[model samples]
Target: MFEQFTQDARQTVVLAQSAARRLGHHYIGTEHLLLGLLSQPHTLAARLLVVRGLDLAYAETTVLRLLGTPGLDARDADALGTIGIDLSAIKEKVEATFGRGALDRDPAHTRAGRFAGGGHIPFTKRAKKVLELSLREALRLKHKHIADGHLLLGLLREGEGLAAKVLAEAGIDFAQLRADLDRDIPAVPA
Candidate 1:
Protein backbone atom coordinates (compact mmCIF):
# COMPACT_ATOMS: atom_id res chain seq x y z
CA MET A 1 0.00 0.00 0.00
CA PHE A 2 2.83 2.37 0.85
CA GLU A 3 4.37 1.58 -2.51
CA GLN A 4 1.42 3.40 -4.06
CA PHE A 5 2.14 6.52 -2.00
CA THR A 6 3.80 9.47 -3.75
CA GLN A 7 7.07 10.89 -2.45
CA ASP A 8 5.22 13.63 -0.61
CA ALA A 9 2.94 11.12 1.01
CA ARG A 10 5.89 9.01 2.12
CA GLN A 11 7.59 12.09 3.49
CA THR A 12 4.43 12.96 5.42
CA VAL A 13 4.64 9.59 7.14
CA VAL A 14 8.30 10.16 7.99
CA LEU A 15 7.49 13.59 9.34
CA ALA A 16 4.66 12.09 11.36
CA GLN A 17 7.16 9.86 13.11
CA SER A 18 9.31 12.87 13.84
CA ALA A 19 6.34 14.76 15.24
CA ALA A 20 5.52 11.87 17.55
CA ARG A 21 9.08 11.82 18.86
CA ARG A 22 9.20 15.57 19.26
CA LEU A 23 6.04 15.53 21.33
CA GLY A 24 7.45 12.81 23.58
CA HIS A 25 4.82 10.44 22.39
CA HIS A 26 5.45 6.72 22.23
CA TYR A 27 3.40 6.21 19.07
CA ILE A 28 2.40 8.02 15.94
CA GLY A 29 -1.21 9.15 16.00
CA THR A 30 -3.51 10.99 13.64
CA GLU A 31 -2.50 14.24 15.32
CA HIS A 32 1.09 13.57 14.38
CA LEU A 33 0.03 12.84 10.82
CA LEU A 34 -1.80 16.16 10.76
CA LEU A 35 1.37 17.89 11.89
CA GLY A 36 3.22 16.01 9.16
CA LEU A 37 0.84 17.37 6.55
CA LEU A 38 1.25 20.89 7.88
CA SER A 39 5.04 20.57 7.82
CA GLN A 40 5.08 20.27 4.04
CA PRO A 41 4.18 23.83 3.18
CA HIS A 42 4.00 23.33 -0.60
CA THR A 43 1.56 20.42 -0.46
CA LEU A 44 -2.07 20.95 -1.35
CA ALA A 45 -3.16 19.72 2.05
CA ALA A 46 -0.81 22.09 3.86
CA ARG A 47 -1.90 25.01 1.73
CA LEU A 48 -5.54 24.38 2.52
CA LEU A 49 -4.85 23.95 6.22
CA VAL A 50 -2.73 27.08 6.37
CA VAL A 51 -5.48 29.03 4.65
CA ARG A 52 -7.72 27.88 7.49
CA GLY A 53 -5.08 29.13 9.98
CA LEU A 54 -3.91 25.65 10.90
CA ASP A 55 -0.16 26.07 11.04
CA LEU A 56 2.26 23.39 12.29
CA ALA A 57 3.03 25.06 15.63
CA TYR A 58 -0.61 25.57 16.51
CA ALA A 59 -1.41 22.00 15.56
CA GLU A 60 1.55 20.71 17.51
CA THR A 61 0.51 22.65 20.62
CA THR A 62 -3.07 21.44 20.19
CA VAL A 63 -1.92 17.84 19.85
CA LEU A 64 0.15 18.09 23.00
CA ARG A 65 -2.67 19.72 24.96
CA LEU A 66 -5.20 17.16 23.81
CA LEU A 67 -2.87 14.27 24.61
CA GLY A 68 -2.26 15.69 28.13
CA THR A 69 1.46 16.17 27.80
CA PRO A 70 3.11 17.22 31.06
CA GLY A 71 2.87 20.96 31.72
CA LEU A 72 1.50 21.77 28.27
CA ASP A 73 -2.23 21.93 28.75
CA ALA A 74 -4.44 24.81 29.86
CA ARG A 75 -5.93 22.64 32.56
CA ASP A 76 -2.48 22.04 33.92
CA ALA A 77 -1.80 25.74 33.84
CA ASP A 78 -5.02 26.48 35.68
CA ALA A 79 -4.30 23.86 38.28
CA LEU A 80 -0.86 25.24 38.88
CA GLY A 81 -2.25 28.73 39.02
CA THR A 82 -4.62 27.74 41.80
CA ILE A 83 -1.61 26.54 43.75
CA GLY A 84 0.20 29.85 43.10
CA ILE A 85 2.62 28.22 40.72
CA ASP A 86 3.29 29.83 37.41
CA LEU A 87 3.82 27.24 34.69
CA SER A 88 5.52 29.78 32.47
CA ALA A 89 7.90 30.74 35.23
CA ILE A 90 8.71 27.09 35.84
CA LYS A 91 9.30 26.62 32.15
CA GLU A 92 11.56 29.64 32.05
CA LYS A 93 13.53 28.43 35.01
CA VAL A 94 13.88 24.97 33.53
CA GLU A 95 15.02 26.35 30.22
CA ALA A 96 17.43 28.71 31.98
CA THR A 97 18.88 25.82 33.93
CA PHE A 98 18.98 23.29 31.12
CA GLY A 99 19.02 25.24 27.86
CA ARG A 100 16.10 25.97 25.59
CA GLY A 101 13.16 23.58 25.26
CA ALA A 102 14.13 21.46 28.20
CA LEU A 103 10.51 20.67 28.82
CA ASP A 104 9.93 19.62 25.21
CA ARG A 105 12.85 17.22 25.11
CA ASP A 106 12.31 13.56 25.88
CA PRO A 107 15.25 12.56 28.02
CA ALA A 108 15.23 8.93 26.89
CA HIS A 109 15.11 9.83 23.23
CA THR A 110 17.60 12.62 23.74
CA ARG A 111 20.12 10.25 25.28
CA ALA A 112 19.65 7.82 22.42
CA GLY A 113 19.29 10.82 20.08
CA ARG A 114 16.66 11.87 17.57
CA PHE A 115 15.21 8.98 15.54
CA ALA A 116 17.99 6.76 16.89
CA GLY A 117 17.87 3.87 19.37
CA GLY A 118 14.25 4.60 20.26
CA GLY A 119 13.31 1.14 19.06
CA HIS A 120 10.38 2.18 16.87
CA ILE A 121 7.42 4.40 17.50
CA PRO A 122 4.51 2.39 16.15
CA PHE A 123 1.38 4.04 14.75
CA THR A 124 -1.77 4.04 16.81
CA LYS A 125 -4.71 2.03 15.46
CA ARG A 126 -6.52 5.15 14.29
CA ALA A 127 -3.42 6.34 12.51
CA LYS A 128 -3.13 3.04 10.65
CA LYS A 129 -6.81 3.40 9.77
CA VAL A 130 -6.12 6.85 8.33
CA LEU A 131 -3.40 5.41 6.09
CA GLU A 132 -5.74 2.70 4.88
CA LEU A 133 -8.41 5.29 4.26
CA SER A 134 -5.95 7.37 2.26
CA LEU A 135 -5.72 4.47 -0.18
CA ARG A 136 -9.48 4.28 -0.29
CA GLU A 137 -9.62 8.00 -1.05
CA ALA A 138 -7.13 7.57 -3.89
CA LEU A 139 -9.28 4.80 -5.31
CA ARG A 140 -12.42 6.88 -4.92
CA LEU A 141 -10.73 9.76 -6.71
CA LYS A 142 -9.57 7.40 -9.50
CA HIS A 143 -5.97 8.18 -8.77
CA LYS A 144 -3.10 5.73 -9.11
CA HIS A 145 -1.15 7.06 -6.13
CA ILE A 146 -1.98 8.37 -2.70
CA ALA A 147 -0.74 11.89 -2.10
CA ASP A 148 -0.77 14.20 0.94
CA GLY A 149 -4.21 15.44 -0.03
CA HIS A 150 -5.49 11.90 0.07
CA LEU A 151 -3.97 11.53 3.50
CA LEU A 152 -5.81 14.64 4.69
CA LEU A 153 -8.98 13.30 3.10
CA GLY A 154 -8.51 10.09 5.03
CA LEU A 155 -8.15 12.06 8.24
CA LEU A 156 -11.37 13.87 7.47
CA ARG A 157 -13.24 10.72 6.48
CA GLU A 158 -12.11 8.99 9.65
CA GLY A 159 -13.89 11.85 11.45
CA GLU A 160 -12.88 10.84 14.98
CA GLY A 161 -9.13 11.03 15.11
CA LEU A 162 -7.29 13.66 17.10
CA ALA A 163 -6.54 15.38 13.81
CA ALA A 164 -10.26 15.74 13.21
CA LYS A 165 -10.71 17.06 16.71
CA VAL A 166 -8.00 19.66 16.18
CA LEU A 167 -9.58 20.71 12.90
CA ALA A 168 -12.93 21.05 14.60
CA GLU A 169 -11.47 23.14 17.41
CA ALA A 170 -9.74 25.30 14.82
CA GLY A 171 -13.18 26.03 13.30
CA ILE A 172 -12.46 24.29 10.01
CA ASP A 173 -15.54 23.24 8.08
CA PHE A 174 -14.75 19.62 7.37
CA ALA A 175 -17.35 19.22 4.66
CA GLN A 176 -16.09 22.25 2.76
CA LEU A 177 -12.48 21.16 3.11
CA ARG A 178 -13.43 17.72 1.88
CA ALA A 179 -15.15 19.15 -1.15
CA ASP A 180 -12.23 21.42 -1.92
CA LEU A 181 -9.79 18.55 -1.56
CA ASP A 182 -11.84 16.32 -3.82
CA ARG A 183 -11.86 19.04 -6.42
CA ASP A 184 -8.20 19.93 -6.01
CA ILE A 185 -6.72 16.45 -6.22
CA PRO A 186 -4.49 16.21 -9.26
CA ALA A 187 -5.95 13.89 -11.87
CA VAL A 188 -3.97 11.34 -13.80
CA PRO A 189 -4.57 10.95 -17.52
CA ALA A 190 -6.22 7.75 -18.59
Candidate 2:
Protein backbone atom coordinates (compact mmCIF):
# COMPACT_ATOMS: atom_id res chain seq x y z
CA MET A 1 0.00 0.00 0.00
CA PHE A 2 2.99 2.30 -0.28
CA GLU A 3 2.42 3.21 -3.89
CA GLN A 4 -0.55 5.50 -3.45
CA PHE A 5 1.08 7.56 -0.75
CA THR A 6 2.54 10.95 -1.46
CA GLN A 7 6.12 11.41 -0.27
CA ASP A 8 5.09 12.96 3.04
CA ALA A 9 2.49 10.33 3.81
CA ARG A 10 4.98 7.63 2.94
CA GLN A 11 7.49 9.21 5.27
CA THR A 12 4.97 9.01 8.09
CA VAL A 13 4.48 5.32 7.43
CA VAL A 14 8.22 4.73 7.32
CA LEU A 15 8.61 6.58 10.58
CA ALA A 16 5.84 4.56 12.18
CA GLN A 17 7.50 1.34 11.13
CA SER A 18 10.80 2.52 12.49
CA ALA A 19 9.18 3.44 15.80
CA ALA A 20 7.61 0.00 16.12
CA ARG A 21 11.01 -1.58 15.60
CA ARG A 22 12.71 0.74 18.04
CA LEU A 23 10.08 -0.07 20.64
CA GLY A 24 10.36 -3.77 19.82
CA HIS A 25 6.66 -3.86 19.14
CA HIS A 26 5.35 -6.58 16.85
CA TYR A 27 2.27 -4.61 15.90
CA ILE A 28 1.92 -1.08 14.66
CA GLY A 29 -0.20 0.92 17.08
CA THR A 30 -1.55 4.45 17.24
CA GLU A 31 0.82 5.32 20.04
CA HIS A 32 3.66 4.24 17.80
CA LEU A 33 2.35 6.60 15.14
CA LEU A 34 2.11 9.37 17.69
CA LEU A 35 5.69 8.69 18.67
CA GLY A 36 6.65 8.62 15.04
CA LEU A 37 5.19 12.10 14.65
CA LEU A 38 7.01 13.24 17.73
CA SER A 39 10.28 11.90 16.36
CA GLN A 40 10.17 14.49 13.65
CA PRO A 41 11.51 17.78 14.90
CA HIS A 42 9.92 21.00 13.65
CA THR A 43 7.04 19.11 12.09
CA LEU A 44 3.70 20.76 12.67
CA ALA A 45 2.38 17.53 14.16
CA ALA A 46 5.10 17.54 16.81
CA ARG A 47 4.64 21.21 17.57
CA LEU A 48 0.89 20.80 17.88
CA LEU A 49 1.31 17.86 20.25
CA VAL A 50 3.65 20.00 22.33
CA VAL A 51 1.03 22.72 22.42
CA ARG A 52 -1.42 20.15 23.73
CA GLY A 53 0.89 19.63 26.70
CA LEU A 54 2.09 16.21 25.64
CA ASP A 55 5.57 16.30 27.00
CA LEU A 56 7.88 14.01 25.04
CA ALA A 57 9.55 12.54 28.09
CA TYR A 58 6.24 11.97 29.83
CA ALA A 59 4.70 10.38 26.80
CA GLU A 60 7.70 8.11 26.41
CA THR A 61 7.44 7.04 30.01
CA THR A 62 3.73 6.38 29.67
CA VAL A 63 4.18 4.32 26.56
CA LEU A 64 6.92 2.29 28.18
CA ARG A 65 4.79 1.72 31.25
CA LEU A 66 1.88 0.65 29.12
CA LEU A 67 4.11 -1.84 27.34
CA GLY A 68 5.39 -3.13 30.68
CA THR A 69 8.85 -2.04 29.73
CA PRO A 70 10.38 0.38 32.20
CA GLY A 71 13.57 -0.37 30.37
CA LEU A 72 14.10 -1.99 27.00
CA ASP A 73 14.47 -5.73 27.44
CA ALA A 74 14.30 -8.82 25.26
CA ARG A 75 12.20 -10.63 27.86
CA ASP A 76 9.48 -7.98 27.63
CA ALA A 77 7.88 -9.73 24.67
CA ASP A 78 5.42 -11.61 26.85
CA ALA A 79 4.45 -8.45 28.65
CA LEU A 80 4.04 -6.63 25.35
CA GLY A 81 1.72 -9.37 24.09
CA THR A 82 -0.70 -8.74 26.92
CA ILE A 83 -1.16 -5.12 25.90
CA GLY A 84 -2.60 -5.14 22.41
CA ILE A 85 -3.18 -1.97 20.40
CA ASP A 86 -5.51 -2.43 17.46
CA LEU A 87 -4.10 -1.20 14.16
CA SER A 88 -6.83 -2.48 11.84
CA ALA A 89 -9.43 -0.26 13.44
CA ILE A 90 -7.11 2.71 13.09
CA LYS A 91 -6.59 1.81 9.42
CA GLU A 92 -10.32 1.81 8.80
CA LYS A 93 -10.60 5.25 10.29
CA VAL A 94 -7.67 6.37 8.09
CA GLU A 95 -9.35 5.07 4.94
CA ALA A 96 -12.50 6.92 5.86
CA THR A 97 -10.49 10.08 6.40
CA PHE A 98 -7.83 10.00 3.68
CA GLY A 99 -9.06 7.45 1.12
CA ARG A 100 -7.00 4.62 -0.45
CA GLY A 101 -4.72 6.83 -2.45
CA ALA A 102 -2.61 7.71 0.54
CA LEU A 103 -0.96 4.31 0.82
CA ASP A 104 1.76 2.58 -1.17
CA ARG A 105 1.16 -0.03 -3.83
CA ASP A 106 0.24 -3.57 -2.90
CA PRO A 107 3.16 -5.93 -2.28
CA ALA A 108 1.48 -9.06 -3.61
CA HIS A 109 3.83 -9.32 -6.58
CA THR A 110 7.04 -8.49 -4.75
CA ARG A 111 9.08 -10.91 -2.70
CA ALA A 112 8.07 -10.89 0.94
CA GLY A 113 11.21 -9.64 2.59
CA ARG A 114 11.98 -9.10 6.22
CA PHE A 115 12.00 -5.56 7.61
CA ALA A 116 15.00 -4.49 9.66
CA GLY A 117 15.60 -8.19 10.28
CA GLY A 118 12.06 -8.44 11.65
CA GLY A 119 8.74 -9.38 10.09
CA HIS A 120 6.67 -6.79 8.29
CA ILE A 121 3.76 -5.19 10.10
CA PRO A 122 1.81 -2.91 7.87
CA PHE A 123 -0.13 0.06 9.21
CA THR A 124 -3.54 -0.88 10.53
CA LYS A 125 -6.54 0.31 8.55
CA ARG A 126 -7.23 2.95 11.16
CA ALA A 127 -3.71 4.39 10.94
CA LYS A 128 -3.97 4.70 7.19
CA LYS A 129 -7.29 6.49 7.60
CA VAL A 130 -5.84 8.79 10.21
CA LEU A 131 -2.99 9.60 7.84
CA GLU A 132 -5.46 10.26 5.04
CA LEU A 133 -7.48 12.63 7.18
CA SER A 134 -4.32 14.37 8.33
CA LEU A 135 -3.16 14.96 4.79
CA ARG A 136 -6.56 16.12 3.65
CA GLU A 137 -6.92 18.44 6.61
CA ALA A 138 -3.54 19.95 5.89
CA LEU A 139 -4.47 20.50 2.27
CA ARG A 140 -7.87 21.90 3.12
CA LEU A 141 -6.35 24.36 5.51
CA LYS A 142 -3.95 25.42 2.74
CA HIS A 143 -1.10 25.03 5.12
CA LYS A 144 1.20 23.48 2.47
CA HIS A 145 2.78 21.60 5.33
CA ILE A 146 1.63 18.60 7.26
CA ALA A 147 2.43 19.12 10.93
CA ASP A 148 2.17 17.07 14.08
CA GLY A 149 -0.66 19.29 15.21
CA HIS A 150 -2.67 18.27 12.18
CA LEU A 151 -2.07 14.64 13.12
CA LEU A 152 -3.23 15.36 16.67
CA LEU A 153 -6.36 17.02 15.35
CA GLY A 154 -6.95 14.00 13.15
CA LEU A 155 -6.70 11.74 16.19
CA LEU A 156 -9.18 13.96 18.02
CA ARG A 157 -11.60 13.64 15.15
CA GLU A 158 -11.05 9.89 15.11
CA GLY A 159 -12.82 10.01 18.51
CA GLU A 160 -12.86 6.33 19.37
CA GLY A 161 -9.26 5.44 18.64
CA LEU A 162 -6.63 4.41 21.18
CA ALA A 163 -4.75 7.66 20.57
CA ALA A 164 -7.80 9.59 21.68
CA LYS A 165 -8.16 7.32 24.67
CA VAL A 166 -4.53 7.97 25.60
CA LEU A 167 -5.08 11.70 25.27
CA ALA A 168 -8.14 11.46 27.49
CA GLU A 169 -6.18 9.50 30.07
CA ALA A 170 -3.60 12.26 30.01
CA GLY A 171 -6.37 14.77 30.88
CA ILE A 172 -6.40 16.30 27.45
CA ASP A 173 -9.85 17.68 26.77
CA PHE A 174 -10.51 17.36 23.09
CA ALA A 175 -12.67 20.42 22.78
CA GLN A 176 -10.32 22.61 24.71
CA LEU A 177 -7.38 21.19 22.81
CA ARG A 178 -9.07 21.99 19.53
CA ALA A 179 -9.79 25.50 20.65
CA ASP A 180 -6.21 25.95 21.71
CA LEU A 181 -5.02 24.55 18.42
CA ASP A 182 -7.18 27.04 16.59
CA ARG A 183 -5.82 29.90 18.60
CA ASP A 184 -2.22 28.77 18.34
CA ILE A 185 -2.13 27.65 14.73
CA PRO A 186 -1.33 30.44 12.32
CA ALA A 187 -4.09 31.34 9.89
CA VAL A 188 -3.67 30.19 6.33
CA PRO A 189 -2.98 33.08 4.03
CA ALA A 190 -5.86 34.18 1.82
Candidate 3:
Protein backbone atom coordinates (compact mmCIF):
# COMPACT_ATOMS: atom_id res chain seq x y z
CA MET A 1 0.00 0.00 0.00
CA PHE A 2 2.83 2.40 0.76
CA GLU A 3 4.59 1.64 -2.51
CA GLN A 4 1.93 3.47 -4.46
CA PHE A 5 2.12 6.66 -2.43
CA THR A 6 3.73 9.67 -4.08
CA GLN A 7 7.03 10.94 -2.68
CA ASP A 8 5.38 13.95 -1.09
CA ALA A 9 2.57 11.80 0.20
CA ARG A 10 5.03 9.36 1.75
CA GLN A 11 6.88 12.23 3.39
CA THR A 12 3.59 13.46 4.76
CA VAL A 13 3.08 10.16 6.54
CA VAL A 14 6.55 10.34 8.07
CA LEU A 15 5.78 13.84 9.18
CA ALA A 16 2.57 12.56 10.70
CA GLN A 17 4.44 9.94 12.68
CA SER A 18 6.86 12.60 13.82
CA ALA A 19 3.99 14.86 14.80
CA ALA A 20 2.48 12.07 16.87
CA ARG A 21 5.84 11.38 18.49
CA ARG A 22 6.43 15.05 19.22
CA LEU A 23 3.03 15.23 20.83
CA GLY A 24 4.02 12.29 23.06
CA HIS A 25 1.26 10.24 21.54
CA HIS A 26 1.71 6.47 21.53
CA TYR A 27 -0.44 6.07 18.45
CA ILE A 28 -0.75 7.95 15.17
CA GLY A 29 -4.16 9.42 14.57
CA THR A 30 -5.88 11.50 11.87
CA GLU A 31 -5.05 14.67 13.78
CA HIS A 32 -1.40 13.75 13.37
CA LEU A 33 -1.99 13.26 9.67
CA LEU A 34 -3.48 16.75 9.51
CA LEU A 35 -0.33 18.09 11.09
CA GLY A 36 1.68 16.13 8.55
CA LEU A 37 -0.16 17.64 5.64
CA LEU A 38 0.18 21.12 7.08
CA SER A 39 3.90 20.58 7.75
CA GLN A 40 4.73 20.29 4.07
CA PRO A 41 4.40 23.63 2.36
CA HIS A 42 4.85 22.26 -1.13
CA THR A 43 2.17 19.58 -1.22
CA LEU A 44 -1.21 20.10 -2.82
CA ALA A 45 -2.86 19.03 0.39
CA ALA A 46 -0.97 21.63 2.39
CA ARG A 47 -1.83 24.35 -0.07
CA LEU A 48 -5.46 23.38 -0.03
CA LEU A 49 -5.64 23.25 3.72
CA VAL A 50 -3.85 26.54 4.09
CA VAL A 51 -6.06 28.19 1.52
CA ARG A 52 -8.92 27.21 3.79
CA GLY A 53 -7.12 28.85 6.76
CA LEU A 54 -5.74 25.69 8.38
CA ASP A 55 -2.17 25.62 9.67
CA LEU A 56 0.01 23.51 12.00
CA ALA A 57 -0.43 25.63 15.12
CA TYR A 58 -4.17 25.96 14.67
CA ALA A 59 -4.51 22.26 13.97
CA GLU A 60 -2.36 21.35 16.93
CA THR A 61 -4.27 23.62 19.28
CA THR A 62 -7.67 22.41 18.12
CA VAL A 63 -6.74 18.73 18.17
CA LEU A 64 -5.11 18.87 21.58
CA ARG A 65 -8.02 20.74 23.06
CA LEU A 66 -10.48 18.26 21.59
CA LEU A 67 -8.61 15.13 22.71
CA GLY A 68 -8.10 16.32 26.31
CA THR A 69 -5.70 14.78 28.84
CA PRO A 70 -5.65 11.11 27.98
CA GLY A 71 -4.15 8.18 29.87
CA LEU A 72 -3.75 4.56 28.80
CA ASP A 73 -7.14 3.20 27.80
CA ALA A 74 -7.85 -0.52 28.05
CA ARG A 75 -7.91 -1.10 24.31
CA ASP A 76 -4.57 0.66 23.83
CA ALA A 77 -3.03 -1.32 26.71
CA ASP A 78 -4.31 -4.51 25.14
CA ALA A 79 -2.81 -3.49 21.85
CA LEU A 80 0.53 -2.81 23.53
CA GLY A 81 0.36 -6.14 25.32
CA THR A 82 -0.23 -7.91 22.01
CA ILE A 83 3.06 -6.43 20.86
CA GLY A 84 4.83 -7.85 23.96
CA ILE A 85 5.19 -4.57 25.81
CA ASP A 86 5.02 -4.76 29.60
CA LEU A 87 2.62 -2.07 30.79
CA SER A 88 3.80 -2.37 34.37
CA ALA A 89 7.29 -1.17 33.48
CA ILE A 90 5.86 1.71 31.51
CA LYS A 91 3.59 2.67 34.39
CA GLU A 92 6.52 2.54 36.81
CA LYS A 93 8.54 4.82 34.57
CA VAL A 94 5.71 7.32 34.23
CA GLU A 95 5.09 7.26 37.95
CA ALA A 96 8.78 7.74 38.70
CA THR A 97 8.70 11.07 36.90
CA PHE A 98 5.15 12.34 37.44
CA GLY A 99 4.84 10.74 40.92
CA ARG A 100 2.57 7.92 42.07
CA GLY A 101 -0.88 7.11 40.63
CA ALA A 102 -0.14 9.02 37.43
CA LEU A 103 -0.78 6.10 35.10
CA ASP A 104 -3.77 4.65 36.97
CA ARG A 105 -5.66 7.69 38.27
CA ASP A 106 -6.84 8.32 34.72
CA PRO A 107 -5.93 5.00 33.16
CA ALA A 108 -8.82 5.19 30.75
CA HIS A 109 -7.45 8.30 29.07
CA THR A 110 -5.30 6.51 26.49
CA ARG A 111 -5.42 9.55 24.27
CA ALA A 112 -3.12 11.39 26.67
CA GLY A 113 -0.33 10.21 24.38
CA ARG A 114 2.46 10.86 26.91
CA PHE A 115 4.38 7.65 26.07
CA ALA A 116 5.59 8.81 22.64
CA GLY A 117 9.22 8.85 21.32
CA GLY A 118 11.67 5.87 21.27
CA GLY A 119 10.66 2.69 19.52
CA HIS A 120 7.85 2.34 16.99
CA ILE A 121 4.51 3.98 17.62
CA PRO A 122 1.56 2.04 16.35
CA PHE A 123 -1.26 3.53 14.26
CA THR A 124 -4.62 3.94 15.92
CA LYS A 125 -7.55 2.16 14.29
CA ARG A 126 -8.74 5.41 12.71
CA ALA A 127 -5.27 6.22 11.42
CA LYS A 128 -5.07 2.83 9.69
CA LYS A 129 -8.53 3.38 8.28
CA VAL A 130 -7.48 6.79 6.96
CA LEU A 131 -4.53 5.28 5.10
CA GLU A 132 -6.76 2.59 3.63
CA LEU A 133 -9.33 5.15 2.61
CA SER A 134 -6.65 7.38 1.09
CA LEU A 135 -5.63 4.54 -1.18
CA ARG A 136 -9.24 3.87 -1.98
CA GLU A 137 -9.78 7.53 -2.88
CA ALA A 138 -6.79 7.42 -5.21
CA LEU A 139 -8.04 4.26 -6.88
CA ARG A 140 -11.53 5.65 -7.16
CA LEU A 141 -10.17 8.71 -8.90
CA LYS A 142 -8.24 6.46 -11.30
CA HIS A 143 -4.95 7.93 -10.21
CA LYS A 144 -1.69 6.04 -10.56
CA HIS A 145 -0.76 6.71 -6.98
CA ILE A 146 -1.98 8.27 -3.80
CA ALA A 147 -0.94 11.81 -3.03
CA ASP A 148 -1.53 14.30 -0.25
CA GLY A 149 -4.75 15.42 -1.86
CA HIS A 150 -6.02 11.88 -1.68
CA LEU A 151 -5.14 11.87 1.99
CA LEU A 152 -7.26 14.97 2.49
CA LEU A 153 -10.08 13.18 0.71
CA GLY A 154 -9.68 10.21 3.00
CA LEU A 155 -9.87 12.43 6.08
CA LEU A 156 -12.97 14.07 4.73
CA ARG A 157 -14.65 10.77 3.89
CA GLU A 158 -13.87 9.42 7.33
CA GLY A 159 -16.11 12.14 8.75
CA GLU A 160 -16.44 10.70 12.24
CA GLY A 161 -12.75 10.94 13.06
CA LEU A 162 -11.10 13.70 15.06
CA ALA A 163 -9.46 15.20 12.00
CA ALA A 164 -12.80 15.49 10.28
CA LYS A 165 -14.33 17.06 13.34
CA VAL A 166 -11.50 19.53 13.54
CA LEU A 167 -11.90 20.38 9.88
CA ALA A 168 -15.59 20.89 10.39
CA GLU A 169 -15.04 23.05 13.43
CA ALA A 170 -12.63 25.11 11.39
CA GLY A 171 -15.48 25.73 8.93
CA ILE A 172 -14.31 23.48 6.12
CA ASP A 173 -16.99 21.67 4.19
CA PHE A 174 -15.69 18.34 2.91
CA ALA A 175 -17.98 18.16 -0.06
CA GLN A 176 -16.87 21.57 -1.28
CA LEU A 177 -13.28 20.79 -0.54
CA ARG A 178 -13.50 17.68 -2.69
CA ALA A 179 -15.20 19.62 -5.43
CA ASP A 180 -12.54 22.30 -5.31
CA LEU A 181 -9.81 19.69 -5.47
CA ASP A 182 -11.40 17.96 -8.41
CA ARG A 183 -11.53 21.26 -10.17
CA ASP A 184 -8.00 22.38 -9.34
CA ILE A 185 -5.92 19.22 -9.00
CA PRO A 186 -5.81 16.80 -11.89
CA ALA A 187 -5.56 13.11 -11.02
CA VAL A 188 -2.88 11.41 -13.11
CA PRO A 189 -3.97 8.22 -14.81
CA ALA A 190 -2.30 4.92 -14.02
Q: Between candidates 2 and 3, which one is better according to TM-score?
A: 3
Model 2: ten consecutive residues of lowest lDDT: 101-110
lDDT tens digits, residue span 1-190, model 3 = 9999888888888998888766656678999998999999887888888889888889999987787646656688788999999776887798688654454333334445344334566788998899999988887888888888888888888888889988988899788899876665557622
Residue 54 Cα positional deviation in candidate 1, in Å, after optimal superposition: 1.1
Residues 43-62 of candidate 1 have per-residue lDDT tens digits of 99999999999999899888
User: For model 2, how does the per-residue alpha-carbon lDDT over 1-190 read when each residue is reduced to its tens digit?
Assistant: 3443444445666677777665545556677677777676566556666766785566666775565533335445445545773444544576566443112222341234343335677777677677677666666666665555566666777776556666776787788877775565544422
Q: Each candidate: how many clashes? A: 0, 29, 5
Leading candidate by TM-score: 1
> Total clashes, candidate 1?
0
Choose the strongest candidate by lDDT.
Answer: 1
Give candidate 3's error at residue 92 in angstroms.
22
